[model samples]
Target chain A: MAEHDSGGWTLERTIPSETAIGSELVSGLLAAMQEYAWPAAELFHVQLAYEEAIVNAIRHGNEFAADKTVQVRLSCTADEVRIEIADMGPGFDPDSLPDPRAEDRLEVPGGRGVMLIHELMSEVTYHPPGNRVTMIKRRPPSP
Target chain B: MAGFERLVVVDKEDISVVRFVDRKIIDASEIEQLGAELLSLVDIQQRKRLLLNFEGVEFLSSAALNKLITLHTRVKRAGGTVRICNLHPQIREVFAITRLDRMFEIASSESAGLAMF
Candidate 1:
């Protein structure tokens, strides 16, 4: 509930894992991030990546558990912005994910979310036990 | 973000181009909004072509890709065509993975997109 900012670094909210809360978290993060002057394209990328991660936590991690919660922590500095999305779901093997681009499996209906996340973020890592996703994006150097 | 700005251009020849003008299509909200806006481009009584310009879009989500398919189906059902152009390398990889590059007419540039009609 307490938000803090220092030297262009700020920490936002911790939200629940219900779909109803997803939009609010996204909007709040976007609003806070806008102050850091992220370019519109990168802003959108962050928004999308965050949404996908939270949705996965809500739908897959919590398995729609009404009592479950997902924590979203955002911090931004002059050089980079970092987001940590943690869920209580049973963690799965990230390596087990099939290649979404496999030539023979082109018609598959799912499995692209993580791929998109990897493409957008400067760094991505998964924490076991709680199934936390950490993503970082660096700001473009000033001209 | 530098070279292009978000530009939705509708030509009199019945083509609508929604240019991303930046690095990616990130969320379902923007994708839905784009679909809605594309629909509004035509009068209900007429059919129109659609071209999603990804010149600046470096990344794309599966949700956005699904929305594109939905848009294509809707426009096709209405007797129009849907084309895609200027896919960034990463985005092109996505389309290839989903095999959507085969589903849609993809061109290298705006002119190529126009020529598809």
Candidate 2:
């Protein structure tokens, strides 16, 4: 695991792909994030987004392989916060997923994590080969 | 980056309401802790009603929704009811996308939520 201090308002960490260990690792990273004076709502958004992304990495990206690892890096400034979750799994097309809002699929469960990430964060992008996802949320400027 | 507040209100009738007073964010671990607390309350009581007031929560993620489902299922199986009230437009969109809107009873106001019992 790798973590670094990008001056103030930013912290980053990396972890293995083990699902059980990944969850607790990300949870601790989120707890450290709370030390900053971020708005309570954004804090929750960040935590949830992190969980969804990291869990996906451990489960989908690495295919639950205990040998592989995932990388999570968080960067925050006075104006925004960005988190990049990268995994060793084969990347998939983000466009290929069926729309969760489609009338025919309204009753189906699961498949909302990606959509939720898009709604909560300002940006969500993916890189191929490595199956890495980078999510960003811009905090409103201080009054 | 909106401010967030959460409260657990217990009525004289033994009903417990968990209110999300502001936008729930990534830093709000208290919300999860609150869920565990609510579950414990259900374990101790045979029948109770839980009203989750989302008056100011503008957005919710899958993680948050999972916690809600966890609480709802636990409370319901224990002879309790969980109702959600005052979903912001964005939050409603989340519910619609996840189809959770169908799984839980949603109300526009606290009174409406309390009326579910």
TM-score of chain B of each: 0.80, 0.78
Listed for each candidate, the true contacts retained, as a fraction, are 0.18, 0.23
Q: Compared with the true structure, what per-residue lDDT tens digits does model 1 show for residues B61-83?
A: 67667666666666777778788
Kindly report which residue pairs in candidate 1 clash with one another.
B23-B58
Provide TM-scores for the models: 0.65, 0.62
Q: Candidate 1 falls in which docking quality class? A: incorrect
Worst 10 residues of 1 chain A by lDDT: A1-10
Error of 2 at B105 (Å): 3.0
Tens digits of lDDT, candidate 2, A33-121: 56566676676667667777877787788887878888877766555678888898888787888877676754454566777677778
lDDT of 1 at A112: 71
DockQ of each: 0.18, 0.18
